[model samples]
Target chain A: MEPLLSCENVSFSYENTAVIKNLSFHVNSGDYLCIVGENGSGKSTLTKGLLGLKAPAEGKIIRGSDLHGNEIGYLPQQNPAQKDFPASVFEVVLSGRLNSRRFRPFYSKEDKKIARENLKKLGIEDLIKRSYRDLSGGQQQRVLLARALCAGSKLLFLDEPVTGLDPIVTEEMYKLILELNRKEKITIIMVSHDIKASVLYATHILHLNFDKSFFGRTEDYIKSPMGKYFFSE
Target chain B: MFNFAEMFQYSFMLRALIGGILISLCAALLGVSLVLKRYSMIGDGLSHVGFGALAIGSAANFSPLEFSIPIVILSAFFLLRISENSKIKGDAAIALISTSALAIGITAASLSGVNTDIDNYLFGSILSLSRSDLVICIIVFIVVMILFILFYNKIFAVTFDESFAKANGTRVGIYNMLIALLTALTIVIGMKLMGTLLISSLIIFPAIISMRICRRFKTVIIMSSIVSVVGFFAGLVISYNRSTPAGASVVLVNLAMLIVFYVIGTVSDKIKAKKFLKQ
Candidate 1:
């Protein structure tokens, strides 16, 4: 079967500084592909290109018209409070239900149901009533994760989703991600700075260096020069 | 002693009450979204821009609405365009547009000899307004309502995340422009009751006060409307009795309520923390 997402030779640059160069990757259905590179190695560019945030200067991305009707759910790195934003946790999470339907202004019963369920799944159900700006770093990360979950997407893309969380919370978040891909049958693509966590959770890995792009199963990549360089102690 | 029954019997006072309520509802609704998107200063900027536009309108013998929309639209178009680029920070961009528009407005009023009645623009005098002003208020209220309903999701989504909204099918530029245009138009109409200097207080004060108490987005809007309605009428009454500027009194009432809400928020936060600890 053809992959759910396929990018062909995607290249992008900002004014002449090439961020992504001749990059190509295909994300299979239910594949947990964790991408890693040194900072500014086009990891974010590829992620944005996948979501069509920045159009490629060179290639084509075929998401194939919403393969299952629900598309991508993305949780960017920035916290809602870091922006000093003024929305409650429930309000922010419910916003993720934007694509669910429109004729009504208020959140429907099903919308609340999905949000409550997602919060429960993420183990932060009690924080549903709290203000998003008032939460700590770890709690905010969980709330954001549940918000992304409320989108009811088949594929979830996270950009550095677990930065600043405590070690225990980080483990829980990564474990939750693994469960999302394995049991929920969702495709999870993320750019993680934690190489050890990437090795611990990712089913497959993509490594981009200044010259080459490498992609394979995680076990096979344990010895690749790019992988060793990234995961080196 | 002022007689309340006398003011109640007057047609002008009645229109002020009705127009004030409707306009309050419109501003309160849009204000919530504005606060969330971190574009609070746009309200102040557009209000000043409206003053300039109003000056031009009076000078050229045209309706303020007709003259104001184009100028505001032109400025809003540019502001929205520059926002996408990181060339200048957000507040700097807003400051640049706001100061320029304000300077031009002052210069236009001065040069045109258009009888720059500061009272009319600052504190809208009920005694001087004609039937046309009421009609304009009604039209503006309807326009705000229509815009709010027509692009509900698009507006909310844009406020939530600009990039994500663009990534989906929503046109961010059009929505941003629509918001700015409506804001500029609202400020122009708002100036009739509020005056140019104080109209932004009308947009933000209620939202800021209600935000301290409310947890829901829609609730904040509803609460803000209630706060605005109460403050506007109370100010009208006080201004009548005390002979103060109507615009300034209304703004003062809003500020007082904001302070009260601030105290309440602080006290409640402590009480909640105490209760949680005791548990």
Candidate 2:
């Protein structure tokens, strides 16, 4: 079977200066792929490209025949503005079903059921009525994760999900993501700066560097020179 | 002493009340999204554009409402485009457009030598709302209401997070344009009663005041609409009794409501904090 998503010689640039050049990678179903890179390594641009927010300057990104463009669940980095936003957990999660609603003005009963089920899946059912802004950071991330699950069940793209989180919460978050991949067989493409944790949790690793990039199984990546050098640093 | 029965006796007063209340409802509904999106001043900028359009229309011997409607709507789209794609930020873009429009309007009114009642346009004269204007106000109000109800969820999603909304294929641009279009319509109709200067208060105050106490978006929207309508009514009553300007008095009433809501929110927060400490 074809991989879930494949990028062929993809290049992205800002104002004629290339950030990601001739990058190629593929993500298969049930794969936990960690994209590790330093600052300004085009990780953000690549994330935008994969999410269909930005088109590659060269080459193409192909989704699986079964996966529609909007079917990819995306949990973007939390912006400061959203920290003080006024919305209930239920409302935030329910909004993730917007694509499923299509032409319908309001969410249907089935949509509401899916939202509740996702909340329950993430063990955040009790937070349904709570104000989203008032929740602790860990709880907020969980709520957002539940929201992402509501958007798409098969593929998830998380952008630095553990950023700003305490070490314990970060470990918990990583465990939760691992559980989703192992039990639910969900495909996860996580972009992170934490190469240590990324190597520990991810089944596959895509290390993006300014001049050189590597993509392979986690074991092979750990043996690769780039990975060894990164660990040494 | 204010005479409740006699206030409704005059036909012009009734027209003002009906038109003012309807515009207030529409403004408040759209204002919640605008305030949250940090586009609160778009109303003020668009109203200034409407003033310029009205001045040019009057000078050209055209129907002010018909001519200004399309122009103001176009400016709304232009404002959105430049703000998104250009280097100019949102507030700066609004300021640029509004000041230019105001300057052009003032120059055009003076150059035409039509002896227009510019003060009425600047400060608003509620009693000057003609029957035809009132009819237009009613139609716009209905359209705004229906569209708002139909797209409420999409609007909420867009306001809360534009990137997430777009990622889910929510067509964030279209919803944003829809908001801009509705705000333009509301500002134009409201400018006749609230004036170019004070019209944005109708769009800003209600949303901000309701947000003081409402923790949820739905409640914020509902409370905003209620506050706007009640404040408009009370302002009309006070203006009628004291013989004050309708626009200024309505804004004053909204300000008073804001203070009241602020106090209530603070008190409730203190009570909740105390209970938490006790526990």
Best by TM-score: 2
lDDT for A183 (candidate 1): 90
- By lDDT, the best candidate is 2
lDDT by residue for model 1 (B1-279), tens = 778888779888888777777777788878877777767787877777777787777766788767887777676666666665678786787787777777776677778775746448645665645577778788889998887877775676688677655545456788888887777667777777888778888788888899898866667767998998898988888888788877888888888999999999899989999998999
- Residue B110's lDDT within candidate 2 is 90
TM-scores, all candidates, are 0.92, 0.96
Runs with alpha carbons beyond 4 Å of true place in candidate 1: A64-70, A79-88, A102-108, B114-119, B122-124, B149-154
Q: After superposition, how far is residue A16 of candidate 1 from its true place, in Å?
A: 4.0
Best by DockQ: 2
User: A1-233, model 2: which lDDT tens digit per residue?
Assistant: 79999999999997678998888999999999999988989999899899888899999999998888689888989988788778899999998898888888999899999999999988889999999878989899999998899899999999999999999999999999999999999999999999999999999999997547999999999889988887776
- CAPRI quality band, candidate 1: acceptable
Model 2 C-alpha lDDT per residue in residues B43-158, reported as the tens digit of each score: 88999999988887787778888999999999989888776774768788789889999998888889989544567788898777999999999999999999999999999989
